[model samples]
Target: MLYDYPEYYETAFSFRNIEEESRFLTKCINRFSKIDVKNVFEIACGNAPHAGLLQEMGYSYHGLDINRNMLDYAAYLWKDLPNKVNLHEASMVDFKYPIKQDFAYVMLGSLYLNDFDEIVSHFNSMSNLLNSGGLYFLDWCIQFGDPLAHNNNNRFVIEKDGIEVESEFNIKLLDQEQQMYEEVWTIKINDRGRRKQFNMVERNKAILPDQFLRFIKERDDFEFIGWWKDWNLDNPIEDENNVTRPIALIRKR
Candidate 1:
């Protein structure tokens, strides 16, 4: 799988502006967070992309990922930082952490629950780790449009450090009633003339805007803040058709 090769995978998705994203996250904490965020946790964190950056800002960093290679690479990548980062090998749904987190986030819609029951369990676990007034930020995790109509974003190419990586993403409905989807990702990499290909498949449970609101309403530990577009607080999700890069935040009660 592409995730096994940390260098190639980071290069493939390096288009992300980490500095801008880190700044936005800090702004969110300043603008919306009710408590002083001392430490941050990342779910399904790959390569710990924001580890060093967030650490530099004085917040301790912690991340969890199921992939061993990703965790190993993240440890090595941030090993020399002044404040050491905590890396854990576990699934996001029910991972256990003794330390309480002030802010937690997951990027790129990596929430892969199989059903509503799992979703509930995931939230339950999250509630255990986050203290009151903590915030949970989700990016591209809510479905506001037809996944099948996202053909324009299915194919992309990226180049970094003499390595060209091409990625193709396709989604197929697995079950209509359950809102389950099968995502197929094909990655082609050329590392200084060494060509290789990798394929990965994952199943995800899509959480719609209304459904997510209702889900949080049914729970007592969390309160839905709101969902936005393009990472801008001013650009609230007004129209489903124009929902590009949806971002949602929920605060612990």
Candidate 2:
């Protein structure tokens, strides 16, 4: 899989503006966090592209990922930094940390839990690892618009520094009763003259807007803050019309 190759994986997602994302995270912390933020953690942090940036911004960085190669690559990239990024080898659904994080975030719709039980467990795990006033920033984890709209512009090619990556994504309804979907991602890569391909298929629970709010309401440890579109707090999502890059925030109670 592309995730096995950290270099190729980072190259494939090189289109993201790391500086802009870091700035957004800073703004989120400054604007929403109810605690004195000291450190942060990234869920499913592959290669932890933001470790260096977070360290430079004066926040201790920690990450959790199941891939050892990704963690090692992240460490090697920031090995010279004054504050080292500590990475834990674990799954996103359940894990514990010796040091609790003041702020937590997951990017690019990577919350892979496939059922209500898993979702509850994930939040329970998060509650255990965060302080009372900590915030969790979730990006694109909810299916706001039509969940079946998977046919348009699902393919893209990204090239950086002699490496080319072509990626295609497809989503299929798995179970309508529980709102589950199966996602298949195919990646074809070319490094100079060599060619490689990887495919990843996974089942994820489709968390809808109403379902998310209801779930948050049922939980005793968390309270829904709000959701926005395009990373702008002023663009609050009311009815899911302009659901471009939807992000939600919830605070630990």
Candidate 3:
């Protein structure tokens, strides 16, 4: 959708916007008993549009993102709210808060990266932050087939105030031995006949559904609770790659 647009993302979240973000967070909050949810933490919180949403639900939640610019924007937006939402600019790989949380969330495919070993290491690290039987909600992209075997490319263009921003997604085959795949993204921001483009990409060492299940099984502290292939709250069943993305619900045992 308009999520790729830097301008739109600078102000608010994409698609569901603030209202839908509120509803989603509220649903997550309700999952636990009312006595257990005084503090909430969200990793890779982006602009923290969801912070305002959490505040409305009576949670004094904290948001963390790696980017300083996005954190500044979040602080500015939530300055007037009655309940203060904390924002931290730090990498999820090494973030440690003073207080342990009853539940944590890392939205979208933010945790997936090029390194399979590192991904598991990162997941293992989160276990220490969780309370007994604490929940960790994660969402990730699922590769149905061999990701390196297929090439998919798409382009998204957005125009705002005479400025045209174009994001081109180009898939490059890396290593098929481990189903490794990389997509290079080039974003061109043009205005008044002048243009500047930013090139960024994610190289994911792909893991299929079965592989993910096996990996989770090896973890001693977390138990697989539920998996939703699509974001739909009602129907949780769908094939890989065909689904929007998967939301993984885990509990510490």
Give RMSD to native, each candidate: 0.9, 1.1, 3.7
lDDT of 2: 0.88
* Candidate 2 regions with alpha-carbon error over 4 angstroms: none
lDDT of 2 at 6: 94
Q: Per-residue CA lDDT of candidate 3, range 78-180, in tens?
A: 8999988888777776557777777788775666456776666667667767777677777664555544333444666767667777767677778867777
CA lDDT for candidate 1: 0.91
RMSD of 1: 0.9
Top-lDDT candidate index: 1
lDDT (CA) per prediction = 0.91, 0.88, 0.67
* Candidate 1 local lDDT, 1-253, one digit each (tens): 7788999989988999999999889989998899999989999998999999899998999999999999999999998999889999998878789899999999999897888888988899899989899999999999998887775668999999999999998989999998899998899999999999998999999898889999999999999998889889898897676376799999999
Cα lDDT tens digits, model 2, 167-186, are: 98898888889988888889
How many pairs of residues collide in model 3?
0
TM-score (C-alpha) between model 3 and the true structure: 0.81
Error of 2 at 4 (Å): 0.4
Model 2 compared with the native: what TM-score?
Answer: 0.97
